[model samples]
Target: MSNATVRPLGYDLELISTIYISHSKNSVLPLLVASLMVNDISIIAIDGDHIDDVRTMIDIIQHLGAHCIQEKNRLIVDARDLQNFDANIPECSSTRYSLLLLGALSARLGKSKVALPGGCDLNRPFDFHITCLEAFGNEITVDNRSITCIQKHSPKTEFSLPYPSVGTTLQAIFSTVIGDSRLAIIIRNTALEPEIDDVIAFLNKAGAKVFRDDSNITVIPVGRGSLSAVSHEPIHDRIEASSYAFAAVATRKVVLLKNCPVKLMTQALTILEQLKCIFYIQSEHDILVDGRSIEESDPISVVTQPYPGFPTDLQPILAALCCTLKAVSHIRDEVMPHRTGYVKELEKIGALISSDGNKITIMGFESLSNAVTVNVSAPDLRGGMAIIILAISNGCDIRIESFNQILRGYSRIISNAHILGGAISHEHP
Candidate 1:
């Protein structure tokens, strides 16, 4: 496990200022792979900050025979001469998002094999993905370490997800777009997150016809070799934006987040407002958070749901902020029940928190002011961000084990913390 040391950098209220965050790479990865399904000599350029897991996915695609290159803020991919179909690599095993390769490669080639994915120990099962693939008439076999998928026949034209899972939705889309173009695929109860819409837009721009109505998504495939080259810029990272907003609130700093997707974060912004953190929507894509008023605010309640609801990803960060409040707060993560692994680590920092099933109750106290130097391991991605927020808010020295957990999602976290006047450094081993 990699470790990160966060030293106390006494808060300078004057140093708090605006920071620019790039578009969501989580929203970019599926599109990057989807671009490769198109057999075109024309280059597909994706504009975003590609680092950490995004870079890992790029490497995986290159290994699968796509010509991928990084040029500053853009990733250029040429899949015209694509050959390999196997993605059973160590890199794939390390990042869970690599599972999307199964669907993409299965459509491009008749069969594909990939190492079982690993990321945060969130207890998120890949069975939903396998179910979605099987719905498309694919044959799947699982070993202890890897999964192999083979196209048995033409994919099914209609399928409905038992739950609105984002990964499964993307899998269904990839399977349809690159499958038999004669079929018009219809998917019900699909996740309507901005990232899902972004992928649909990329597919449409690349010559596939995809439409979303309410909770259902319809894909009209344009057949293989018909999808031409296209360039797409992914939407800004709403989860990343919310994380910084929560940091500002936890530390009582005024932070202007540029390129933030204010609309996509309406639910999170509403919750922040209830906590007395004022927001100035400078533009459609920028928000200024005045968190100095948080002390006067009452504790708030949050329930995580799909898009347009308080995001489950921000639940841990909010729970951390609640610890610094003077009243009780309640949070229910209806999305992922086993996501409270960070509560124990937060307790080490003096947070009074408990969990019952998916419900969490936090007895708010001034834990930040009483924080002491501590060593903790990040339980997951957002959980690590929550830990760092507590340490930065309290100006407490902390050693965070398994720091790579944070890098899996937030590639620019260290640099962004530095911009916020945080004294943080990580050492890889």
Candidate 2:
């Protein structure tokens, strides 16, 4: 857990008006790790709203001898003095992003011992990352606790991922950037997430040659000591923006999401339209979602896919919204099979939800009969958001525990909810 303070949500929270929210910290954290490959200072200007959530990654990099300073929205990272390559500490195990360090560390220091990562219980294995590193001529040993990798003299020139995993794709690119300048590494079937493109743009700006063609990515290795300092601002978080949109629709409120990336949210917007929610794209970056008149629609059937498709991250949020409708909804998450852990949590608060493997069946009710004050716990990040949305939409006097999990992905959630006329507060002991 981080040193940042967390306060649970009080009872009977309701979002009754419009609210404006900032971007998330998801896209910028990877860039921060990429900055470590540079021998010079790299400046990253992140949205201040969720900057506190980035402290875990900064602390992990600092443990590896990188000097990182956070000043409001701006982060200054100096990796010229990085001396530690072993990332077996607790911080590395806190989030799965630490797995990216295997490539960065091995490329810079020749070897890395990274503990197995821990995050949401999404049933995602680390074999994809291991396969990518092993293809790069890195001898890897995995045990119950950690994975150790040592680079060999001759690295493979090409590899292909069995699945389009975003983490494995990033590991392959980072490991290829600074080793064997004569080799041009090719990675096929890579994830086409916008964040991957953001990382590629950042790397290209910092003197790395990385290109993408459809599902394949090519990284032309630059010689050691080639990367230079660069400043980058990551694109807005599409998942965060969609979360707010779902919240608006669930609570029947009008919310104007500022600095939202509307283009990246094609599938989500399409689904919202199906739900009869109104959207006014104020500009390329702003959207006004009016959900005050949401009507009963047909049953919704959604399948989670990669970029440009229905996102698995938003499945929980959508599931929560479906619980309030008069029709049944089915959500299948092919990406993360075990993502339905929150179904039980939602059921605790009078929601009719059931899970069978990766598929979730939501028997929507016309209205919730809230006769008692119920307390529920957040199972994970996205799942927690789902529970909160359901609680507010029903106007149930529910107390939510483990809200810190929700804070991991969302910034200033309670304050933003309050701004939208939600009667929410910290749960005092």
Candidate 3:
């Protein structure tokens, strides 16, 4: 291994291992397995560690239990996790964008649904499920911290969101009508992250009514019908891909991300612009990044909110970038509680970051001097990965714990580091 110390970040990192699920693909693996079991699908995760073996596993998923278990669970099903789509619940197959399920479930199933919103609090700016349901003539009443939607006269026949809520977007589309009918949904001041578009496109593939204007989306509802099974690969995840790219920037090293789509990373690219990081987007899949000349940028401001704004997922990496800069920077996480607030780990990396509710004020420093072991618990995925970047950049042995959350986002991060020219990996003893 390189001279760099093996500093892992996260509160629970010490206990977990580089899990070799061998037989099954992870990401949303657990969720898929759960879905398979509940639906009585004939799918099983084996103990094999190769692509060919996993393909066989998918063959089982292709034809199995016909029933789908729509029970509620706090599952993180982003599009990046699946090797292939779920055939039984193709509508629900792609978990990453599963928030779209809220609409269809409510309409045909009579609006009875429960599911956890993923990503940090910043991810959910507005709840779209309620908006579309009310517009569709569904009597949506708040039930003590829970929302209940009851269809009353097939809804108002018109739906829109003050903001484009994925949950709301789905609700509006499904509530169209039993037959062909025209409907409109207003998604004003709404941001459309590429991932949201993934689900919209999927619905369109299934022949759902969907039309979007500058800020509003007009989705012609596709009434209940056994839509033909559609097959299409999910777009490569730019968020996960860019995190590694940001890692290269943190260490001031050159890391080329192949199989990555550059168009989706415009927002992160813009912020990196402020840092003066040189990014060469050669092809659709290739992104080469070289950092500034070890020079610190002036103090800057980063507010992490919903899409179109700086992503909350990138806040941790940006915070790591802030630490390298010898200036004051502000990262305000306006969504979750104490999310970017976890800048305390930055203190371990030798940066000054303070938490005040949803806002974080970071003071850039020249360098965080050498330290024995920098131990910190990761509050979430990006935050956790950032600690790894901080360790690599500052030459510190950072121990990150609570990797369970981090793994939900990044797949085989250590492998990524090993493949790239950044840090070395070591199993915790």
TM-scores of the models, in the order given: 0.92, 0.92, 0.69
Error of 2 at 326 (Å): 1.1
Model 3 C-alpha lDDT per residue in residues 317-337, reported as the tens digit of each score? 877877777788887776444
Clashing pairs in 1: none
Per-residue CA lDDT of model 1 for 213-332, tens digit only, reads 988898876656778877878888898888998888887778889999888888878877687677789899888887786654487788899887888999999998887787889999
Give candidate 1 misplaced runs (Cα > 4 Å). Answer: 1-15, 41-49, 295-297, 365-372, 419-421
Q: lDDT per residue, candidate 2, 5-73, as tens digits?
A: 778732223443445545445567788789889888888877666533477788889988999877887
Q: Each candidate: what lDDT?
A: 0.81, 0.82, 0.52
Q: Which sequence of candidate numbers ranks them by lDDT, best first?
A: 2, 1, 3
RMSD of each: 7.3, 7.8, 10.7
Error of 1 at 418 (Å): 3.6
Q: How far in Å is the alpha carbon of 344 misplaced in model 3?
A: 2.0
